[model samples]
Target: EGGVGYCGARRLKGGHLRGGTPAGAGLSYYYDPLPTNCVADWFCLEGNSRHLPPDPLQHPGARPDLNLAVFYHACNFNCLYCQNWSFRKATFSGGKVSAASLAQAAHERTACICFFGGDPTPELPHALATSRLVAAGVGRERRPVRICWETNGAMQEAWLKPLAASSLDTGGIIKFDLKAFSKEIHLALTGVCNSQTLKNFAALAARLEERPDLPFLMASTLMVPGYVDLEEIHGLARLIARLNPNIPYSLLAFYPQFYLRDLPVTSRDFAFKARQVALNAGVKRVHLGNVHLLT
Candidate 1:
């Protein structure tokens, strides 16, 4: 189980285990042998203009290229509408790579490295190690290589503080997918309570005050038809606004996928309405993602 702990309490111990759900006296997290796939989906190497902080959008001429590393076969949540659901059956056998090897992938051209999943929480150790290696300037001069994370925001405080600190130091952003506002509906949609996620978000929001120049924190929600409606959007917006109205929130269009294929793709009107709801709730920066999926 050579992977990072979800709570950052420990590093992945040396072993041949692929992955497993482990818990301590009062702590719970997952451990996985640096799963076979290192980089799942690499995109926007030329720099994704949509990323927050408006650096790329504000200065199109100075766009910083980014590299996304999508880990496989590790997630704590069970969202029926999971677009990357295929990771559940993905085999990491003979596909695992060491932290140093993975870090090598982030060359000088890479301005940022985003660790996403299934969910990075389960593979926190590997991600952390890779981030540290990249930050140390593995091959190039000691230039900054932003370390970012897109996660469900359910990791314990023990692991989160350091992760946030790392991103804060590197000018990277940590994006949390707040599935839903209502606890009941959130459970219904993701098959897990969002209490921990919400708690972690509040904690991270407070941390953002230390580094205002960097868009260190972000939030997003999939506009699932019927499940995540205007009301849900408003509720989530208000929650985020309560902490910091400036916190950018993205309303994502949901496409019929996995176990939720019966549902229609999120409509353009719904996406717009969700944005309006978030704006009306006092959020200053709200936008729509996956617009192509909107009918």
Candidate 2:
């Protein structure tokens, strides 16, 4: 495989859950730009969120200025609602550079770095190495560095452990994307059950051991059509409420994209309605996505 070599979405016996080349859906590994060392750019957005540039009034949050961004590849989950399906399913990239050069790119811009990806947490070893390199890059200068990872809670704690441990010390932001409350719904959309996710989430809480001073947030979208409905939203809200209410869970609106093109577009009303469903179920602070709700 002359590409972003991903093996399988299989669970190892005594090791981490990883993409397997064994059987079944067989790890849909591919690559695209941004998730690479070269040609990647860093925006000076606050806290290093890899957000798209302003377009009209559709920006999610106007407060946090974007900082630096490093694009990574491969995902453990095949969520039907993934907007970056092209990037996830595609393989290869244009830019080719070393981690040193990548650190240089970051240094040239802002202090914060967003490790963007199909899901950055999978390649934890690579991510950790890159982080060390980036840390070393700015260490001498005493430049403030914050690491932020955007991930779906598909991989188990075995896989996420190393990253999570390192993340907090680096002033990292753990943006966990919890797909669904029910394991069935999670399986239906992301091809994996939410059991490990739930377990890992609880594990994270346990790891906190009385406020470990970690910055984290749980994010999720209310995928449309086949993915979720009003009842599912209620279930998810209840799930999150049992965990942590303070964490802002983004209840995003759906749009017809990728395999869901034939489905209806997520209207602004539908988005708010979904948010309301989450709220009604006791989830605090539901943020709408893929819609023009905020102004």
Which candidate has the top score in lDDT?
Answer: 1
> What's model 1's lDDT at 157?
72
Per-residue C-alpha lDDT of model 1 across residues 1-295, encoded as one tens digit per residue: 6674432223456654334322111111222222112111112112334543445322444533445454545677889999887765543322455666666777644666777767778667677877787777643333477677889988777888789977888877788999999999999998889999999999999887887754688898999998998888999999999999988788888999999999999999888988988999999988787787899
Clashing pairs in 1: 4-125, 7-159, 36-95, 36-96
TM-scores, in order shown? Answer: 0.79, 0.70
Error of 2 at 289 (Å): 2.5
Runs in model 2 lying further than 4 Å from the true structure: 1-66, 88-98, 140-143, 207-214, 293-295
Per-residue lDDT for 1-295 in model 2, tens only?
2233342223445454533221112112222223232111221123224553442433344322335665554677776666777765333433233444555555434446666557755555555666677777664334346676777665655766666655666655566676677777778877877787777766664444333333344556555755677777788777777776644567665666676678776666666777888887777667765555222
